[model samples]
Each structure stands twice: as C-alpha cells, then as structure tokens.
Target: MSGATTPGLPRLGDLAWAPALDHPELLAPTVAEALRAWAGRDDRVRDLVAVTEIDPDHADTATLNDMHGLPPEASANCVVVAGRRGDVEQVAACVVTAATFADVNTRVRKLLDARKASFLPMDRATAESGMEYGGITPVGLPAGWRVLVDSRFAAPDVLALMGSGVRRSKLLMPGELLCAMPGVEVVEGLGVAR
Candidate 1:
C-alpha cells in the first residue's frame, strides 16, 4: 500500500490494485456476491484477489494490455457458449489465456454433451448472466452454468487478469485460485494455441 507496487502480487504495470471489497463501484452485483463467497470459502483467495479500475474503452484484453503495459500472457478471456441436448439448454463460461482460444466446437461441445456449441449471442449472454458483454467473467455466472478453466491456468504462481463483470475494471488473482471457484473445472486442451 505504501509504494506503487502491491507486495506479493504479480507486476501489473501502471494499474493500481486494492482489495475488491474496497471498490464496490467496480463490481457488478453478481461479481460482488462471487467475491464474498470465495472469501468465505478460501483464505488464500480472500488474501490475494484484487481489483483495479480501467477505462471502459480499454477493457478488451488487447487494448487493456497495451494501454496499461501489462503482459498479454498474464491476461485471460472468458467466453460464453450455449447449446442444447434434447430439450435441455446447456451453458458454460470458458476461461483461457489471451494467447490461446477456447476450443468451443470440440472440447466445449464434448464437455456440454451437446451435438453443437457456439458462442452465445451477446444479448442472451448479458441477459441470462447479468454481466456486460466484453466484461463477462467466469465468476458469478448462474449456478447451473459450468465454468471451464484451461488446465494451463493451474500452473504455480500464475496471476490471471480477468474481467470484473463490468467494463470499468478488472480482477487480478492466482490462476489456480480461479480454478478453485465453485463449479469450476480444469480441463486439458480446453484452449488451443491460436
């Protein structure tokens, strides 16, 4: 808190981070609930997860990384997908490093046990999950929605920069911690090299 750097956190270039609890305005309602639930369940997560504000225009991974001087490798993108099996609808949020792309048609379809899977339309994603487009995150997704995290994220000491459910901010935390979120599943080959 004293210097420009946050002790123990991975370098985030020019972004200033504080406990997520200290910046309620940066979080959507569901995101706040997700953070609270994680904090209650994991001491490590409670101690490490942080949030920082950013310009909405620079919220996308590429722009945010370039404008903030953050490493692209340290960032992750979440994508939503929807598919149906018989009469049931299946939805999931896929998390992968910015350097890779989610294998939605193959792995995701297999995981959801659907004949086909595709990116959910933006309006439907936003309406169903209550998260803004381009800012949808794995955290706080509806209870029945699966959260698929790429296995690479389980690497030790990896810090992932992800959306905060709103365009105005982002969350930073250990990638492994995100893998531990309720209903989160780490799958090998979930993300394919771009």
Candidate 2:
C-alpha cells in the first residue's frame, strides 16, 4: 500500500503516507486500538494521523531519515524512563526531536519526583508497553505512565515522525496533536542536545 503521492497527508520527503485508520495492519495492535478509540470521538486523529510502511531494517530513526531524506531534527524519538522510591515506581515516555536527547537525569527526574531515574531495559519496555522494542510510541502506553513532550515539539505545522508501535511502519502526525495527546505534559527544557 504505497500512499505515495497521496495529498493532504502530512509527510516529509517522498515517504508514502496512508491514513493510519485505514491500515491497522501497519500499526502494532495497541497503537491501532488507541487510534481507533481516539478517532471514534474525534475524527481529527483519523484525518491528520497517517502511517507509511518501511523495511524493518529502516525502522531506526537515523536509517529511516537517511532513506527518506527526512531531516534528523524533524523526527521525534520516544524514550522510556523509570524510577523507584520505596515501593512506588514512576514511568514516563519522553518525546523529543532527534536533534536532542531527553533530559532524563534532571528534568524528567524532577517530573517523576524520583530520587534517581534511568532508561528502562528494552525487554521490560517492550513487554510492559505492549509494543516492539524499536517501535514503541507514546500512544498506547500502559496505565499510570505519563507522556512528557519536549516543548520544542508543541508547535503548529511541525510534524512528529515516530514509531507506529511496530518496526515496519512509521506514523506521521502533527506535533500539536502529539502535545495534545492523552497524558501528555509539555515541558520546557525537556530536551538536551545530543
């Protein structure tokens, strides 16, 4: 399903983009479910959010960007961080442009109110989030998890090219929509240059 040349779908470079709602197979089950549920109430998600298939080998941000001529800074990366204090565990997904890394040590630690915080292990991240290792998006994260968006991504006309919860496809969405997503907290200074 090459949606290449399809008009109205937000895209960078020559990547094909079809409505994510129309290609559930391209999305991880949880992502598809979340989008469907959100779209049921607000059709904007269906209209503005789209997906494009790519070789799983190109799923990594750098590789995909290089393959499609997408600028590195235009892509958003989802990083999962977790911390514990006594018996309580805090988890958050930080969304930042590829030009920077999430400020996990300071900003995110304060946000989570944890004494220390670090990236979650890949195995647990995939299992707990119900998403693949390289394709975890913030959309379908489990309960009690917060989505922390770097303020840089909270603008109109900005696009967040991110995982579709699967390695073989990517989602293209307005950065505004990502900031407006459920459980999102837009914080300034959340991103640190890589």
Candidate 3:
C-alpha cells in the first residue's frame, strides 16, 4: 500500500531491512496472528517483511527463472521436512536459493536423528506450517522445532523470500535478518548450488 505493488507480496526492492523487524503488514493472516502472539510476549524478534509472488505450478530451479524473472541465486525456497525420533517430533524448515538444494539426507537427518526422514509432501508441509502449499516458510512453523539455514544466506545483499504462514502471501526480508531470527541456526559451510 505504500510503494509499488508486487504480485502477491511486497517487493524486496520496496523496504529497507534494518536491525529490527518492523514490517507486520506484509504477513498473511495466520503468520500475522502468530507474529502478533510472539511479539506480544517477547520484544526481541523483529518482524521481517515479505513480498509475495505466487505461481500456480510450484516453481523449481528451472521454472523459477521464467516465472519470477529473478535470478536463481537471488531467490530462496523454503522446504519443510518432518520426522520423529523417539517422542520428539522433528521438523526442519529450510531456506535455500534456487541455485542450491538443501542436503535433506545429511544436514537434516542427523539433526532429527531419524534413520529415515523425508520431505513432507507439499500439501502436508503447507498444511502443518499454516501456509500455502507452495509458500511454506520457516518463520512461523510449530515451536520448539529446529530451523537450520544455509550459511550462504548470511550474505549482506541477499533478499530472501519466505512464507507468511499462508500460501498466497510471502515475507521478503534481508537474509541476515532471517538468520538472526530466534531459534535459527546457521550450519557452517552448508549448502550446495543447484
């Protein structure tokens, strides 16, 4: 509403990523509610802003180029992989650029300590994350679950897009800020380019 409109979310070009997460208007309903709940209790986490761009067909490495017009390395995808070890329900929601793919078998497997782990089907991931099927983000996933990020996302210029707890919308914020989100862990030397 303040600047030029993006497809479904705000454009990363429109806002400044500051030390504090200041954009709450960009969130979809569920994420907004969760953020409000979280922010209401603790004042530490910044509310990162996101601009959404939706595609009917889930955009993969090649399709993203034609659909979003954003360079592959410049954009990231949030993939949700869930598993259970003993009584703990392990959920790993990752954000990696189109130029890379999350090492699901290695990075996530050990974290969850599951002999077998698998990516939650798109429908289930979206459903559990409370976001759209194609727009699942690591932001407002179920609490107490570990969220691991690729170390590459810590770069200064990267404007990472994540889910806003809903499919039809997104939260666009600085990659550094995302890495700083509460409970986010940066795996050293992790990530492989696609």
Q: Per-residue lDDT for 1-194 in model 2, tens only?
A: 75345567787778878888889999988999999888887768978898998999999999888888998777989999997777888999999999999988898999999888999999999999999988999888897898899998887689999999999999998988888887789989899987
Residue 109 miss distance in model 3 (angstroms): 0.7
Candidate 1 versus the native: TM-score?
A: 0.94
Count of backbone clashes, every candidate in sequence: 0, 0, 11
The lDDT, on a scale of 0 to 1, for candidate 2 is: 0.88
TM-scores for the candidates: 0.94, 0.96, 0.73
Candidate 1, residue 68: lDDT? 83
Q: Which pairs, if any, clash in model 1? A: none
Model 1: per-residue Cα lDDT over 100-175, one tens digit each: 9999889999999998899999999999888898889888899989899998889997888999899989989888
* CA shift of 144, model 3, Å: 3.3
Q: Which stretches of candidate 1 lie over 4 Å from their true place?
A: 1-6, 9-11
Most TM-score-accurate candidate: 2
- The regions of model 2 sitting more than 4 angstroms off are 2-6
Pairing residues by index, what is the TM-score of model 2?
A: 0.96
lDDT for each candidate structure? 0.85, 0.88, 0.62
lDDT of 1 at 88: 84
Candidate 1 deviates by what RMSD? 1.8
